[model samples]
Target: MTDFLNILLRFFHFSSLLLLTGCLTYLMLLTPAGYRNRLEIRLSPALRSSAGVALFSAIALFALQTVMMSGEITALSQPDIWSAVAGTRFGHAWLPEMLLAAVSFMLLRAGGEAARYLLLVTLILQLILTAMTGHAAMHDGWRGVAGEVSQSLHVLAAAFWCGGLYPLLLLMQQGQRDPQDNTAVLTMMKFSRYGHWAVALVILSGVSNTLLISGIPRHFSFWLTGVLVKSVLVAGMVMLALLNRYWLVPRFRQSPAESRRRFIRLTQAEMGLALGAIAVVSLFATLSPG
Candidate 1:
C-alpha cells in the first residue's frame, strides 16, 4: 500500500511538473506574437489547472513521504512526523517547491507576459528542488552536484519536449480552422529548431544521470528496465519529431491541410510515447536504483 501510494503521488508530481514546465516553455519560446492572444486564451485554463495540480501534488507528496518514513499510516497525527518532515533531506527540499507551486498557481491567473515569465522562473526553481532530493542527490561531493545538475537539465528538457505537445496540438487545431494562416507552420518550425536542442540536452543529461545513478551494470533490474523503456519511448518520440520536421512540416507549403492532419496525428503518437515514458519514470522513482 505504501508503494502504491508512493507511485501515485510520484505520477501526479511528475505530471504536474511537466505540465507547468512545458506550458510555460511553449508560451514563452514557441508561441508567435500574432497568435499569442488566441493561444493564450486556449492555454490559460490548462495552465491554471496544471498549477493547481502542482500545488496539490506537492502537498500530498510531502504528507505521503512523511508517512512513508515513519512507517505508519497513523503517523499523520504524530508530532514526530512534522519534525521529521522539517528536518529531513526530502522535506527540506520539498518545502520551497510547495511554496513555489502556490505562487505559480496564483500567477497563472494573472494572465500577463510578466506573470508568465515569473511563473516560468518559479517552475524552474521547483524542478531544480525536485532534483535535489532524487536519486541524483544520493551521491556525495562534487559527483552528487553533477548528478543533480544533469537531472535538472533532463527534467527541463523532457518538459520542453513533452509538455509542449499539447500547446502545439492546439496551434495545429487553429491552423485547421484557418488553413490560409501560415503562422502555425512558422511557429512549428521555430519550435522544431528549439526541440532539437532540447532533445540533445535530454539525451546528454539522461546519459549522465543513468551513469551516475546506476552505472554500467552486469545484471538487469526493475529500475534498469524502466530506464530502458523510457529510452525506447524517447527514441520513438525523436523519430516522429524528425519525420515532422523533415518531411511533414515542409509539406505545409504545398499541402497545408494534409500536412496539418499528418502533423497532428504524429504529435498525438508522440504524446502517447511521452506519457508512457513519464509512467516509467514514476515507476523508476519507486524502485531501488540497483
Candidate 2:
C-alpha cells in the first residue's frame, strides 16, 4: 500500500512540475512576443494548479517517507520523527521544494514578466532539489555530483519537450479555429528549431546519468527492464516528432485544416507517450539500482 501510494504521488508531483516548467520555458523562449501575452493569460490557471499539486504532493510524499523510515503509522504525529526526517538528505531537498512550491503558487497570482521569471527560477531549483534525492544520491563525492547534474539536465530537457506540448497543442487548436493566425506556425517552427536540441540533451543526459549511477546492468533486473521500456517510449515520441516536423508540418500550406488535425492528434499521442515514460520512471525510481 505504501509503495503504491508513493509511486502514485511521485507521478502526480513529477507530472505537474514538468508541465509547469515546460509551459513557462516554451512561453519565454519559443513563443513570439505577439502571442506570449495571450498564451500567458490562457495558461495562468494551469500554472497555479500545477504549483498547488506539486506543493501538496511534496508534503504527502514527505509524510509517507517519514512513516517508511520510522516504520510506524503514528510517526505522522511525532515531532521528533518529523525533525529527524527533516535533517536527512531527502528532508533537506523537500524543505526547499516546499518553499519553492509555495512561493511559486503565490507568485502566479501577480502579473508581469518579473513574476514569471521568478517562477521559472523556483521550478528549476525544485528540479535540482528533486534530482539530489533520487538514484543520484546513492553515490558519494564527485561521482554523486556528476550524477545529480546529469539528472538535472535530463529532467530539464524533458520539461521543455514534454511540458511544452500543451501550449503547442493550444496554439494549433487556435490556428484551426482561425486559419489566419500565423503565431501557431511561427511557434511550431521555433519549437522545432530548438526542440531538436532539447531532445538531443535528453538522450545524452539520460545516458550520462545511467553511466554515472551504475555501469551497464549485466543481469536482467526490474531496473533494466524499466530503462528499456522508457527508451522505447522515448524513441516513439522522437519518431512522431520527426514525422510531424518533416511530413505533416510541410502540408500546412497545401492543406491547412487536414494537416492541423493530424498534427494535433499526433501531439496528443506524444503527450500520452511522455506521461507513460514518466510513470515508468516514477515506478522504477523506487527500486534498488543493484
Candidate 3:
C-alpha cells in the first residue's frame, strides 16, 4: 500500500508539473502574439489547477518519504525523525521543491503575463531540483553534478515537448472553426521548428540519465524491463509525430479537412503514449535501477 501510494503520488505530481511546464512553454514560445492572450486566458484555470495539484502532491510526497525513512507511521509527529529526514539528500532537494511549488501556485493564481513569466522560472527551478533527489544524485563530486545537469535537461526537454500538446489541440480547434485562419498551421510550424531540438534532447539526455543511473544490464531486471517498455512507447510517439509532420503537414493545404482530422487523431495518440511513458517512469523510479 505504501509503495502503491508512492507511485500514485509521484505520477500525479509529475503529470501535473509536466503539464504546467509544457503548456506554459507552448503559450509563451509557440503561439503567435495575437493568440497568446486568448490562449492564456483559456488555459488559466487549468494552469492554476495543476499548480495546486503540484503543491499538494509535493507535500504528500514529503510526508510519505518521511515515513519511509523513519519506518514508522508516526514519523510525521516525531521531531527527531523529521530532522533526520530533513538532513538526508532527498530532504535537501525537497526543501527547494516545496518552496518553488508554493511560489508557483501563488503566481499561477495571481494570473497575468508577469506572473506567468515568474511561474515559468519557478517551475524550471523545481524541475532542476527534482534531479537532485533521484537516481541522478547517486554519484558524488563532478560526476554527480554532471548527472544532475543532464537529468535536468532531460526533464525540461520532455516537459516542453509533451506538455505543449494540450495547447496544440486548442489551437487546432481554432483552425477547425476558421478555415481561413492560418494561425494553427503557423503555430504548428513554429512548434515543429523547435520541437525537433526538444525531442532530440529528450532522447539524448534520457540515454545519459540511464547510463548514469545504471550501466547496461547484463541480466534481466524489473528496472530493465521498465526502461525497455518506456523506450518502445517513446519510439511510438516519435513515429506518430514524424508521420504527422512529414506526411500530413505538407498536404494540409491540399486537403485541410482531412488533414485536420488526421492530425488531431495522431496528436491524441501521441498524448496517450506520453502518459504511458510517464506512468512507466513513475513506477520504475521507485525501483532499483540495477
Candidate 4:
C-alpha cells in the first residue's frame, strides 16, 4: 500500500511538472513576441491553472513522503514525521521545490512579461532541485554530483520536448481553422530545432544516469525492463516528432488542410507516448535500482 501510494504521488508530481514546464516553454520560447496578447487571451488561464496544480502536487507529495517514511498513514499528523522531513536529504531537496512552486503559482497568476520570465527561471530551478533527491543522490562524492547534474539535464530535456507537445497540438488545432496561416507551422519549425537538441541531451543524460546508477550489466532485471520500456516509448515519440518535422510540416505548404490534420494527429500520438514514458519512469522510481 505504501508503494502504491508512492507511485500514485509520483505520477501526479511528474504530470504537474510536465504541465508547468510545457506551458512555460511554450510561452517563453515558442510563442512570438507579437502574439503575446493572443497568448494572454488563450493560454494564460491554462498556465495559471497548471501552476496551481503543480504547487498542490508538490505539497501533497512532500506530505505523503513524510508519512511513507514514517511507515504509517497517521504519520501525516505526527510531529515526528514533520521532524523527519526537516532532517532528511529528500526533505531538503523538496523544500526549495515546494517554495518555488508556490512562488511560481503566484507569479503566473499575476501575469506579466517579467513575472512569466521569473516563473520560467523558478521552474528551471525547481526541476534541478527535483534531481537532487532521486536515484542520483544515492551515489558517493563526485560521482553523486555527476549523477545529479545528468539527471537534472535529463529531466529538463524531457520536460522541454514532451511537455511542449500539448501546446504544439493546441497550436495545430488553432491552425486548422485557418489552414493558410503559416504561424503555427513556423513556430513548430523553430521548436523542432530545439527538440533535436533536447533529444540529444536526453539520450546523453539518460546514458549517464544509467552508468552512474547501474552500470551496464549482462543480466535482465525488473528495473532494467522498466528502463527498456521507457526507452522504446521515447523512441516512438522521436519517430512521431520526425514525421511532424519532415513529413507533415513540409506538406503544410502544399496541402495546408491535410497537413494540419496530420500534424494534430501526430502530435497527439507523441503526447501519448510521452505520458506512457513518464508513467514507466514513475513506476521505476518505486522499484529497486538495477
TM-score of each: 0.96, 0.98, 0.97, 0.96
* Candidate 1 clash figure, as a count: 0
Indicate the TM-score of model 3: 0.97
Cα deviation at 249, candidate 2, in Å, is: 1.0
Q: After superposition, how far is residue 258 of candidate 2 from its true place, in Å?
A: 0.5
Candidate 4 global lDDT: 0.83
lDDT of 3 by residue, 136-181 (tens): 7789997789899999999999899999888888788778788898
Instruction: Name the candidate that leads on lDDT.
Output: 2
Higher-lDDT candidate of 1 and 2: 2
Model 4: weakest 10-residue lDDT segment is 36-45
lDDT of 2 at 56: 95
Residue-level lDDT tens digits of model 4 in 81-119: 888886889888898889999998888777578878888
lDDT of 1 by residue, 74-190 (tens): 988898887888788887899898899889888887867888889899998998998988898899998899999999999988888889888889889889889877777777777
Per-candidate Cα lDDT values, in order, are 0.86, 0.91, 0.88, 0.83
Question: What is the lDDT, from 0 to 100, of the residue 76 in candidate 3?
Answer: 90
Between candidates 1 and 2, the TM-score winner: 2
Q: Number of clashes in model 3?
A: 0
Give all candidate RMSDs, comma-separated.
1.2, 1.0, 1.2, 1.4
Best by TM-score: 2
Candidate closer to the true structure by lDDT (higher is better), 1 or 3: 3
